[model samples]
Target: MLQYFTLPVTAFQQNCSLVWCDETLLAAVIDPGGDLPAILAQAERRQLKLEQIWLTHAHIDHAGGAGELARTRALPIVGPHPGDQFWIDGLPQQSAMFGFPPAEAFTPTRWLDDGDTVQIGNETLSVRHCPGHTPGHVVFHAPQIERAFVGDVLFAGSIGRTDFPQGNHQQLIDSITQRLWPMGDGTVFIPGHGPESSFGRERKSNPYVGGT
Candidate 1:
């Protein structure tokens, strides 16, 4: 079975998830935005053998800590699609802009695309290329558990803002309606920020992208 714990990090309070395959104890940290020491400490306390660092997008709050953690743990960094390269490249500026600590730009060890599958011990998570929040944003779905780590794409009561450079409102909507919704309404999702919610609940009541 796959198990996870969400750690809210940085001034943005981004949700950084520590996911593991309980059988093997192999773990992957998702959206490691900041507070590297705390994240490492928690993993240590839990006795998790951290293996990979995964990013949902390149926003400073979601990807700021990735480079440092990868360097410290010698783990591979993956995902957020190829389109978010610009955002990743601009990490330093984003950090300065948002009053975060200095951030370093990095290239993913492997770039993911829609339909790609990543493995965490015995569990496999499907990737969905969900743009709008950021062109390269992608959601990680654990089908067996009916759960998703949906970056800033879809939230409990609102959708990701399309006001940033390269953002497109319609694309965000399509990603949610056409890609995310079909995953099954009962699916529970972990957003980049705020509390987690079910796709069913969001689809029925989310003010931004809810209802038939």
Candidate 2:
């Protein structure tokens, strides 16, 4: 069984998720954004062996603690596509501008593309390059579980802000309507900084991408 725990961290309150395969206890930390101590504490408490670090995007709040955790655990860092390389490179500036603690930039062990699959124990998650909020943004989908880590792309009642540099409002909408909507409405998604919600619910009521 694949299980996960969400830890809200950082001044931005980003959602950092610890996901593991219950059978083997092999784990990966998704979006460590900060609050490394808390995430490490919980993973230790649960006795999960941290293996890899997965990212959804390269935003400061989404990847702030990635370098620290990767170095601490000697784990591979993966995903967020190659498109966000600029954002990753600008981590220090972003941190300074946002008054965040210093953040380090590191290259991913693997830069993911659409249709790639990553594994945690026996569980396989499909990757989709869903941009707009960030050009290199991606979503992780576990088909067997009908769940996705959507990052800053689509929110419960709203959508990710396209006002940021390189943010494309139309692309964000297309990613939601074309790429995500096909996942079936029952699919539950974890956004970057808020409560969990179902695609079905969002498609029906979300003011940004819901309804015809």
The estimated TM-scores of all candidates read 0.98, 0.98
lDDT by residue for model 1 (1-212), tens: 99999999999899999999999989999999999998989899889999999999999999999988888779999987999999999999999999999998998999999999999999999999999888999999998999999999988898999999999999999999988999999899999999999999998899888884
Clashing pairs in 2: none
Model 2 worst lDDT window (10 residues): 203-212
Tens-digit lDDT string for candidate 2 (80-156): 89999999999989989998889999999999999998999988899999999999999999878889999999888
List candidate 2 segments past 4 Å from native. none
How accurate locally, in lDDT, is each candidate? 0.93, 0.92
The segments of candidate 1 whose C-alpha lies over 4 angstroms from its true place after superposition are: none
